[model samples]
Target: MTQRADVVVVGGGQSGLAAGYHLRRLGVDFVVLDAQSAPGGAWQHTWDSLRLFSPAAHSSLPGRLMPAQQGETYPDAGHVVDYLSDYEKRYELPVQHGAQAQAVRRDGGRFRVETEAGDWSARAVVSATGTWSRPFLPAVPGQDVFTGRRLHTVAYRRPADFAGQRVVVVGGGNSGAQIAADLALAGDVTVTWATQRPPRFLPDDIDGRTLFDVATARRRALDAGRSDTGGVASLGDIVAVPPVRAARDAGLLHAKPMFTRLTATGVQWADGSRSDADAIIWCTGFRPALAHLAPLGLRGPRGHIPTAGTRAVAEPRLHLLGYGDWTGPASATLIGVGRPARDAARDIAQQLSS
Candidate 1:
């Protein structure tokens, strides 16, 4: 027997939870299917030392503000997990854990969501499956032959495990910078930072809050027919967090250009210079985890489904929430995901009512 709901939100992460919050307010019949055994979404998989760039107040989802311990500025991953767990409990969102959605296909006027647990027929489907499950690694020459340990940021845990080894951290984003700093601080390892381009750093005062504000302003300006000056710092630019700042102070934040190829023992530079390394940590970002939506055949180039304000352009019955800015500006962040989720829920409700 096929279960039915007004909407099926695939992924019970922060994005799906936010959507559930709005849907619950509208009294809509919706179910959030989560892959994990418990709450917290992707936060449970992050490295132990990870911390939000924004303070607790700035990094909150809609409705409830994330509570921080006294004197705690930026909340760690565990804090986020706890907050998410509590938020779901407080709202009593209809989320079914361990129900991993495998595929989604249109069935008559509704959508059929096939999951590990069962099949759900929904009027609309909101894919809040964020990028945590799809860590990306750029292909370089001789990558298959590399003998050393290579890992993406998704699998990274603690720095102690990598102590006393030559480590090369790749990617110019915040993760790379932070992980490099962590490695440098944890042990007497030789840390080599590699980036495709020189890493751009936001000023000491700028954090995720400032970046969101800047993004919002830029979006407004563009919408208002004004030319954006592009002066605001990019969200991808590394922020000088306390640890990153310490790394900079200690002259360990220097970055080298990306290596030309991977050598058996390490990596080779464009100049053919080679250096031995025990491990390579790839902090490259992620692609949207949209495999469940593959049955719909909506994915465009690079696995991204074209969207307009969280609604799929080709498939109006499908709404992709919290994937990234394509769905909504700043939608991938903890605080930023709520807007799109709310909009998605409202749209889904409207569709169902109609």
Candidate 2:
């Protein structure tokens, strides 16, 4: 028999856990399904040397302080995982690790979730799976023909691995810049940052506060209708670290034109320039992975699950927490989704009670 719960939270990260906590507090029975064996989502897969730009004071889940003392430089990726593990233990949240949700469909008034573990039926569902489900690697022609090592930024850990090699760091995001700089120091790195827009960088801190605070303020402004809410492409408001600028100043980094295609030995740029490299690291970013529910007509033109203001457009019983542009202060962060979780949980509880 399929297990039944009042609500099923699909994901065991902070957002899902927060949703589960709220459900339990409201006397709503729920279960959390996570694909990973641990609570941290993408953090568990992050580069080993990665650390948060935001300090510990701002890098916290709702109702729980970050273990690091206030003003401490943001925790490393490992520290994040440890903190998340502690959070899960402290809450005693009903999370089933290694439960990969394959499909979600509405059955009558309830939603049926099919996963690797088993089937679960719930009156409401929380799709807390963040937006980075699928890495958005650019599809370049002859990409497979490349004769060098190619890896996505998600899999890249340390630059020491690429020592003494000519590296081509593609993409112009923060990850691209940081990785390219690190590699340049380690070896003869030629970072071909393919981007149409001019790059902008931010300081590590502004007035003793992190740039994440600025982002949070911008989010609040967008929500308060006092500012223009732009898409992810408009990252001017987002702070880029100073190290990126220093890398450029050190003559180790240079911007390359947009990508045209991949050749057997290297990459070709739109400006008719080509460069050979020992390896390529694609930091193109990621997209939502809802392929399991291809039948669900809930995706936007951009392939993101079209959310009707956080609630799923096609399935009201189904809700999403971190799948949009203005994900509030914590949209993609562990701290950002807490407020959204409370809002979603309240809506789900009201829907169930009524």
Candidate 3:
């Protein structure tokens, strides 16, 4: 059966749920389609010990209060997943799970979204699959020749998985640092971390509040068009840097400048350094999942969809969320994704009513 609506929201993450909640409240007819069987996109697939650097107070979704926790410490991945599941139930939002939209095509004045289940038509679409859907692993020369076990950050759940093995973590981001530290300490594994950029570190607390709290405040100031305090960096960057320094200080991991190539038995560094390892963990990053969105002609460069002023890209009746400060990090975060969601629904509603 073919379903029709004013909008069809792709992806069932925080952004998508926010869009659905706002759309329903506005009396708009719409349906949300999700690739995952459950909500919480990347959170469901993240490393087991992952936690948000943003505190609970600043992290709640729209129309719902964040659950009270004991300390100001960050919430874990499972805690976030639980919150998202609860948010959906509270809103009683309609979502079609496991209905992955494989391709989207334009049909006259309407958009046809083809999923594994069937085809649905909508006047507008919100692509919220997010950037993490596609893990971007660079083609290291001779990667295929490596005989050791290789895993991306997506597949790594716990450091225990690499017990008693030498692990080479290839990436500069927090994920790589954290994983290396965890494995080195818990399992006594030898770990090495490589990156092209040197990480900048920050203290964990400032003026009685946690570093996470200060970061959020800075972001909010930036979003409101107020001048920044000038001493701080982005929350994402700050969060990534400290853990890496901690891991280094603990002798849990060694930081290498960058990776040069992969050999049959190990990896070589640009500084002519080499290491023997039993495993390699790639924590490079991800690209937006838009291979299914080829018909829209929205891709700009590096296979990323280009947005026209944050609401829509080159295509009409299409909106993108979590596209890095479209509404700022407050809306970009797992907890604070509602700001853009509300904006998206409002803009989409206006377009439809016109």
Candidate 4:
């Protein structure tokens, strides 16, 4: 069956919902397609101990502010899941769960979205699929031959699952630090945290709100064509969240130079030093989830679809939301996605009317 709308949103996560909020306000005919069977998007897939970088009140969607959880400053993943699940209903966004978008193509000067459920034709398409689905793992010498278990960030669940094992957690990002700390503090595992470069921890007081402000400043300066101070990258990598801070204070989060190669049972360093391990966790990160947009063939050398603001540069009818700085400053965040979403909706409204 072919359904039709003014705009077809290809993701039903925070970014998609934000677009829905604005589109609804404009009284545009739109529908949100979510691959997941339920709401919460990628938040439902996070590790058990994971928590937000800021309080609920500061982390929110456009139409509604996320309510604070009692007895928790930075709420856990479960809280975020509950919030997102409730958000769609509270706003009455027209979202179809289990509607995995397979591809997007141009048809009749419009866009047709082929999905698991059926097909949707729209004057404009919003590809808001975020990055959680495509976890990245770098190649290393002997990585293929390693007998022990190797897993990426997406596969990691709870530290308790690795109990009593010697684990080598690789990558210098927030995931690596948090997972290593989680293992050291909670799991009965010996963790050797490794990174290409030393991980930088932000000041304890710095959180998502401050990061958003810095991104805003950077965007403003760049728009004005002025010399810009680097945004979030300038501050540091890790935000000393409670778990990471606790582990660091306890001297359990020391990071060593990354191993040069993976051995049969563990990893070997460049200095001929080695650590035996039962498993290796790759906390590297992810690429944006945009495979469904591959049919459009607009991705550039940087593996991103070029865009002016949120609208696709080559195809004005196609808009990319969430995805991160490439699409819009801080747009991948729950709170930061609103402006771009609103702008995208307004642009679609104008295009449809024109």
Whole-model Cα lDDT of every candidate shown, in order? 0.89, 0.72, 0.75, 0.92
Candidate 2 wrong stretches, greater than 4 Å? 69-72, 188-191, 204-238, 242-249, 326-330
TM-score, cand. 3 vs. native: 0.88
lDDT of 4 by residue, 57-122 (tens): 888999788899899999898998899989899989999999999999988888899999999998
Best by TM-score: 4
Looking at model 2, the pairs that clash are 202-240, 330-336
**Candidates 2 and 3, the one with greater lDDT:** 3
Clashing pairs in 4: none
Candidate 2 TM-score, C-alpha based = 0.88
Instruction: Estimate the overall C-alpha local distance difference test score of candidate 4.
Output: 0.92
Residue-level lDDT tens digits of model 2 in 158-191: 8778777767777766777777776765555455
- How many clashes show up per model? 0, 2, 0, 0
Which candidate number has the best lDDT? 4
Look at candidate 2 and tell me the lDDT of residue 223.
71
**What order do you get sorting by lDDT, best first?**
4, 1, 3, 2
Clashing pairs in 3: none
Output candidate 2 Cα RMSD.
2.9
TM-score of each: 0.97, 0.88, 0.88, 0.99
lDDT of 3 by residue, 1-354 (tens): 878988999888888888898999898899989989987766788887766666665567788866855653667778888888998888888888899999888988999999997999999998877777778888889799999998788889887787778888877666676777667666467787777777544455431134434546776777679998542354333354344456667766667787789888889887877788899999887776777788877777767666653465568688887655543344556555676688788888999999
**Cα shift from native, residue 142, model 4 (Å):** 0.6
Kindly report which residue stretches of model 3 are placed more than 4 angstroms away from their true locations once superposed.
70-72, 206-249, 326-330
Every model: Cα RMSD to truth: 1.4, 2.9, 3.4, 0.8
Worst 10 residues of 4 by lDDT: 297-306
